[model samples]
Target: MAVAPTPPGRRERNKQAKLDRITAAASELFAEHGVDDVTTQQIADAADIGTGTLFLYARTKGELLLLVQNAHYASALERGRTAAAGTTGALDGLLALLSPVVECNRVQVDNGRTYLREMVFGDPTEPHHAEALSIVAQTERAIADLLSERTRLGGEEAAAMAGVVSAVMFLNLAPSATADASVPEILATMRAQLAAILPG
Candidate 1:
């Protein structure tokens, strides 16, 4: 007979509520104005929390963006995974697995690029930055699983290929030279690259 897990106490609950408010405020402000144009004070004000409280959650604007975008990226990855399950051909399945992420990143292009930048360059010791990196790892694992199943590749080989695929996806998402490209255009380029890489 094991005891049931304890529920969150009042203090923990209050902390969660504050974090939720901060995430919501940052998400809305970043979407509306892009991360470059938004300020931490604005986020704190929108969250109805003080500036000091906001700093407790995220030290920098980039970290704040990571905290907000990580949730969206995680959800997009799940949608892609679901879509990939019903997909048939290897290329089609790969595309299915990647499409939602592309859509998510491109929704607010500048914000999307900035999120990528932060994920790549922000302090790894930061919790939000670590979460962002974790999502990227999850995405790679999903891709590796699909590739191994469809292409008969060994685990190590599949994971290596998945890393390549992830790189291609990020490059297309954050390309400085093609910042204005549409989702379809980015997908088309990715498809061509994957076509060359995948077993025919």
Candidate 2:
């Protein structure tokens, strides 16, 4: 009798299952306790895994936070990209691109603000700090590409515009406490600013 072969898909599924558990547990713990306060032991316990198992998924809490942050940004960017694809005008594409940032802000307004603060003003030499910067650069490039496709701007001009849009969006979505303003107030201010800078 020949032994049945283990399917490749099954191995992939198992790997994803483990990853899903780690992510979900981390999300819950990080949201409740804040990233700095949360520990791999707590995450492992929450996910019903051994400490060694948690390390297998994430060597450190900072790395795990980076992973989660990357996942969130990627999802939001993909949504914005999809929305922009349907728009005709450059401004419309920009607005579509902004939609996901707004949505993400709404979903995790407090946490988003906290993470941004940590990334921008915290220790710059940290490994995750560089990773965060790289992610922002990639996001800027994506926005630049969208603008270039929809407008007559040169690559430098497109990138500059995208950077401006990104800056405005970041200011708008910044934590109210940090800005001494509310979300609506910041967004309204940003909208007016974008209008002044971006050509119709």
Candidate 3:
């Protein structure tokens, strides 16, 4: 007889259901009308949660953006990791890994500006913010792993280099994220900036 998989506990099932409702509602509204045009009340109503409960999940619109975008960012990191894994060239691998991130910011555009800006000063303890940080850490880890595989650098050196590369990429992308720049141009600039710092 095939054993039935254990179901999630009640509390976990309820939590996941609520999270699904919130993310689905937020993603739909943000995609259809843009984040600037959406309201917390509308999101809460769409998710079938009280306004107060929505606040419990996300304290502000910016945090709500983080919460809504967390899943997308995580998926991007995974895609980037996959891109990195298929290459031997350090720079190409790194570029492949980060292009999706820049593209993500490009897709979000205006909302991305708020999310990126708020991220600088956002509370790490917040659930969405923590998830965002974890995604970034995963990107950094991918870079470090690539470096370790391709370079003779020590683990510490690879880790430090990975952090530097990630920071520079984000900085390079910040202004470009909101500008009229094309994706190819943004990627070109990221490659140029990265090339300048890579040990020759």
Candidate 4:
């Protein structure tokens, strides 16, 4: 009798496994030491791979940083979209979108804050800076569309509100230089601010 053939999907699974290992190592290093302090060699060591192998996945330390941050955002966005799909109203959809962000911020507060600082105020000419900005813009547009569908707000107003909400969320994620606040406190404050800005 002929033996069963090996699954053809194993290669893709293996590749994803490697990527996950690298990303996890990068996230831990980045959280412990700021992105500026973490080197590619160190990342490779943390990931238990040769430096050259790390280079195959990331061109530079900045690229790795961006990759980590993008992965976080994308994951959260997927969760948000999934939650929003089940909601009945625009406000509910907006709440669903923001829920994942708030949850992510609480879970990965240190890494998320570091990534945001570098993305927003870092060298404007950097490619990651542009990419991060584009991602934010796209997210804002998605929020605006959701709002427009639920309320009487026009496109411009919805867009403006989305921008405002984005700004508030960014500020909420900022790392404290002194005393640290609890995650519950931060989420409560964010929720209150968002509620205040959204229409009744």
Listed per model in order, the count of residue pairs whose N, CA or C atoms clash below 3 Å is 0, 0, 0, 0
Better of 2 and 3 by lDDT: 3
lDDT of 1 at 69: 86
The local lDDT score (0 to 100) that residue 43 gets in candidate 3 is: 98
Number of the top TM-score candidate:
1
Task: List model 4 lDDT by residue over 98-117, tens digit each.
Answer: 77776665554555676677
TM-score (C-alpha, index-matched) for candidate 4: 0.72
lDDT of every model, 2 decimals: 0.93, 0.74, 0.82, 0.75
| Candidate 1 per-residue C-alpha lDDT over 28-63 given as tens digits, one digit per residue, 9 for 90 to 100 | 999999888898899999999999999999999999
Candidate 1 stretches greater than 4 Å from native: none
Model 4 misplaced stretches (Cα beyond 4 Å): 1-24, 31-38, 47-63, 88-91, 175-179
Looking at model 4, residue 139 earns an lDDT score of 77
Model 1 residue 154 distance off true place after TM-score fit, in angstroms: 1.1
TM-score of each: 0.97, 0.71, 0.89, 0.72
* Cα RMSD, each candidate: 1.0, 5.0, 2.5, 5.4
Please tell me which predicted candidate would have the highest lDDT against the true structure.
1
Clashes of 1: 0
Candidate 3 error regions (>4 Å): 1-6, 176-178
The list of candidate 2 runs beyond 4 A from truth reads: 1-18, 31-39, 52-60, 118-134, 178-187
- Deviation in Å, model 2, residue 169 alpha carbon: 1.6
